[model samples]
Target: MKRIFKFIENNFFVIVILFVAITLLYPNIFSWVLGKVHGINIMNLLLSIILFGMGTTLKFENFTEVFKKPKEIGVGLIAQYMIMPLLALTLAYIFKLDTALTAGLILVGTVPGGTASDVITFLAKGDLALSVSLTAISTVISPLLTPLITVLLIGNHIHFNPIEMFISIVQIVLIPIILGLLVNYKFPDFTENLKDYLPAVSSIVICLIIGGVLGANINSIYTASWIILVVIILQYFIGVALGFVVGYLSGMKMKQITTVAIELGFQNSGLSTSLAKTHFPNYPIATVPGALYSVWQNLAGSILAYLFRKYLNKEE
Candidate 1:
């Protein structure tokens, strides 16, 4: 079981890809996982579980790290909120995606950085502290930024209430994180024991979320695969390029630059997926980009991390 879990952890992106492929081929197989009861979507429950796991891994020190280096964290946050959303908007227009795809891509841009960035940053010999701090701070502020940005950019295309979206983010994200933090603080030893298994569990939950979304929208995804793929690829790579530019122009160190680049490039697509499913039921295809991104960014980030590590090693 340990070896099996280790394999899953190491090949996280591969598992996601395989699951997504399988779902696309056999939609009903994974589609059943989207079962709901009493008007509540099962994805909401799974998302809460995923967020709770994320909360357990965090510590008070992660928050303090932000204050310790406000300049670095602030720059990272600025790049995150500014670069990605605007780039997404540009790509959406340039590609001339319909309202659903445009909103989906923009939402992906607006959300916080994923924990996967921390892993990639570590692999690239980047500043783990900055990565964690960026992710934590960005996540903490997502309730305000994500909905506001969405409304500002894609409001004309979609009819969503920003207040309701804010409340949903708070309920799905902030509250779960706070609960996990309290548990971690109250039961340090127990949390420590659980931490080892959290990654594997979280990876499975993420794959399930992707599979559910992909299964639900298999037909739409097939029809729009090329356009969505092109836009998502552009969105990620552009964010990476702009992230490095921001860090470089700001006089950040290479390690910090690497951290910023990964942080800005990768997003918490899980949150985006949940938000789309919960809030924009009319546009089911909106969840497609998030599901595809949930797989693509990690694979791209991992490959980039390897190259950065190799280059850094040679320099040393």
Candidate 2:
């Protein structure tokens, strides 16, 4: 059982794609999670579970890692925020996406680097401390930055209230992370024991979120999928390319460059979907990009990790 769970955790990209395909083909199976009873989505609850699990992996030492090399962390955070969000806005206009799709893509851009990124960083032999620091700091500040960036990018294309969105992120993201951090901090021995299980649990939760999004918007996605798919893939590749260039220009080490590139390339798609669904319930299509992105980024990141491990890490 442990080995099976570890395999699922290690091969998360496969599990994610498989689950999303299931929901997209047979919406009824996972669509039930999308159904809101008294205005609460079981899907969002699943998202919280993932976020909390992410927190358990973190330690206060990870936060202190920021001070050890402030420049790399700064470069990573700047690259993280500037590269993806701007590209998302640009692609939204280039594709001439409608309001709902535009909003969804924008949300995808603005969220922080996810825990999957840390895993990819580890896999690629990148600077793991820098990756964890960036993920930690970006996630901590997301409640403020996410909504602010969303307002700047999406603007009038989507009806947005930063305050409402702020509260939603706080509830859906920040709180769960805090609780998980507390659990880890207060019960280090306990957290260590569960560390192996966390990846398996988180993989399942991410799939459920992906499944819910695909199931809910299966019809719209079938008809209108190509452009956003292009946009999401572009957003990732562009961020990665820009991350390498910027890291190189900034004189980051090869490992740091790979770390920055990976961090810039992936966003918190679960949080993006939760925000889209919670705040834009009327625009069901608004959650589509985040869902699709959730699938594509993992696949892309895994492939990237392999290439980086094979080629880039050899340089170090």
Candidate 3:
């Protein structure tokens, strides 16, 4: 058991890769698991558990980093909002994707930096604190900003009740995250010990979630395969380029640049998927980009983190 835990801890990225591979090979297993777990909103439960663990990791000080370095945070935020929506619009125009997919791609771009970015930033020897602050602020602001951005960019493409989206965000995104934050604040050591365990749990559940979504819509892959791959590739390069350019232009260090890159590249596609299901049920394909995104972003992020670490070491 100890060895298993340690193996998961040491090779979390490899585990994610393996999970993706398994899901691709045995896509039906996701449906099997979901069917067996009747009466459970497996996706929500997984997200709640993930957020609960995240809360334990939070510190009040992490939130304060924004106030101290407003400029850095501001630049990061600008890059996030700009790169995502613009890329989505451009890609949608170039490919002439359906409204649902266009909206999904836009939402993926608009959602802020997630907790996973913080882990990758740390792994890449980047600005861990800055990444944490950006992630916290982004998550906190997402309930408002994400919906507003979605409406502004894709409102014409779909019938979006902004009020409904707001409610969904509160139920799915805000409440769970806040509860997790409070849990961590009240019990520091307990949260710390559980940190190593939570990622593995979240990871396995995320894999399941991805597999379930893919299996359900395996048919979409036939027509949208090229489109999905294009969005994934474009989103990644744009994210990395935006991060590097913005960080350099803002006079940040190499480590800070890497942090920004990862933060921009890795999003909370899970959160976006939940939001789409709850509020944009009419546009089911809107969740596809995010679902496939969960798989692609992790693959790219792991490679980028490895490269950044090696490059940083060489420079040092």
Backbone steric clashes in candidate 3, count: 1
Can you write out model 2's per-residue Cα lDDT over 81-199, one digit (the tens) per residue? Answer: 77788888899889899889988988888999988889999999999888888999899889999999889877666776899999878887889988999999999899898887988
Query: Lowest-scoring 10 consecutive residues by lDDT in candidate 1?
Result: 307-316
lDDT of 2 at 106: 87
Local accuracy of candidate 1 as per-residue lDDT tens digits, 38-122: 7767777777787787788889899988678887898999999989999989998898998888888888999999978988988
- Candidate-wise lDDT, in order: 0.87, 0.87, 0.77
Question: Judged by TM-score relative to the true structure, which candidate is superior, 2 or 3?
Answer: 2
Candidate 3 per-residue lDDT over residues 1-316, each given as its tens digit: 6466667756765776676567668767676533325665567667767766766777788778978988888888888887767877888888888887887888888887767888788778888889988888787788788889889998887887888777766666678778878877787777887776787777776776777777666777757888788877887778788889889899988888788888898888887776776667777667788878887787777778788989863474
RMSD of each: 1.4, 1.4, 2.3
The worst-scoring run of ten residues by lDDT in candidate 2 lies at 152-161
Stretches of candidate 2 above 4 Å error?
Answer: 37-39
